[model samples]
Target: MKKTAQPGIEARKNLDFGLDANTPKYWHSNDPFKTRLHDALQSTFPEGERYFIACVRVFNDRIEDPKLQHEVKEFIHQEAQHGMAHTKYNQLLAQQGMPMKRLLAFHKDKTQKDQKRFSPEFNLALTAAFEHFTALLADAYFSNKETTAGMDPKMKALFAWHAIEEMEHRSVAFNVMKSIAKVGYFKRSCAMVYATWMVMYFMFSFADNMLEADGFSKWQRRKMFFKNLNWMYGYKGILSSFTPSLLRYFKPSFHPEEIPVIHNYPDWVKAYDESGNPHKACEALIAAAH
Candidate 1:
């Protein structure tokens, strides 16, 4: 794969949001299924991102490319910010009686166990696979404007900010892996399969738990299930559109740069800044924890 010039990837400190009582229970278009789906993913980030950080950091000394070395540092900072930001969001969910703490604990335990069980190379492979998934989802978010159009403004900005960063550093782990190792196709492919299964499993598990806690009726659950299914797999679904890129991960010679870049990423950054400086948004949370 040829080296393509990438946009600057830096950690913007204090990138926090004002998520308070006003934030709706169903912030994603008032749909329980959609909202819970995002909640599930958010619940995973605190621990999952830390795992990504550790996996990438393990190879930092082995990186010979100066640019990639810097990118790795930026990636670490960005992931740390993401984890902190989402940790705050999960607290907000707990305030809303969403059982976020329990769910997060489950995720944290799983990630810890994986860290203990897996080798550094295997963990790095997992991180690369997971990064690919995030990049694909980021593309989906940007491609489908309606997904953001109906979201609560604060929530939308939060996700948009994350998506933009995800896009910016999508290739960092892949590049690091390629630089340090011989790019084992089998290992990468297997890691992606395992990562995909674990992600889907946890995402749905969290979503289901949230829905049950919200007292969704059987009929409501049935209705929302199909609605979400359609939204995910139907004609205009995000995942449907993402199929091509997702399949590319299976290729022996696949590199993250091979995925097309989001052309209007500058717009995403602007939206995030205008919504609120992430650093400023987290001031209270930072202080309270001290």
Candidate 2:
């Protein structure tokens, strides 16, 4: 497969989301399910992104294209910045009694073992699969305003900003797999299955734990879990629109850039650059979808 065109990926090393104790327990529209769903993903990022970086970096020496090589470096920088920003944001959730460290330990231990047992090629394929998952999420989110309605501005901005970069560099790991690691259709496809299972298992598990901490009983939590699933896959649900794109990964010709994204990244960047306010950046992004 040929290398797809890459948009520039920059590390916005200093943007701040103003996370603090004043932030509410349910920052996503004041709903426990929405808030914890995002928080669950945030809880995984610091360690998971490090794993992504390591997986891609192992093949850096073999990347021959100058453009892709530069993208790889910027990709490292961007993912590192993402990890740091999420770490700080996750700390705010921890202070709210979310059991952040304990939840994080589960993913961390699993990652360590994967590193020990998996080949670098397999890890890179896994990273590519996860990156595709994130890109799918970013595309679904920034495209639809309903998904983010009434979310706290600070939290929304943090996620919108992260989503912007997720779309921007969505292809880096896949490029590494295709161009350098030479991962085939079978390995990448299998990795997507594993990645999908891990995402489903961990995201739901983390959200369930958060609800339990919120004093919901088993029966209530069980009901809430189905509600959350419908919210994701129901008609016009957050992820409902991405079913086709998700399946597109199994195609032999799939590439990240082939997926169209409606988020106005250029305007969002311009807004953030001029004002240095994440909320304004998010506003610009949302407005552009019309």
RMSD of candidates 1 onward, in order: 5.9, 1.7
Model 2 spans with C-alpha error above 4 angstroms? 1-6
TM-score winner: 2
TM-score of each: 0.90, 0.95
Worst 10 residues of 2 by lDDT: 1-10
| Model 2 root-mean-square deviation | 1.7
- How do the residues 44-129 of candidate 2 rate in per-residue lDDT, one tens digit apiece? 99999999999998998888899999899989998999999999988887888888889998899999898889888889999998
lDDT, model 2, position 51? 99
Q: Write the per-residue lDDT of candidate 1 for residues 103-155, one digit (tens) a residue.
A: 88888888889888987888889999999998787667755455455677778
Task: List, in order, the clash count of every candidate structure.
Answer: 5, 0
Question: Which segments of model 1 are wrong by more than 4 Å?
Answer: 1-5, 270-290
Model 1, residue 71: distance off in Å is 0.8
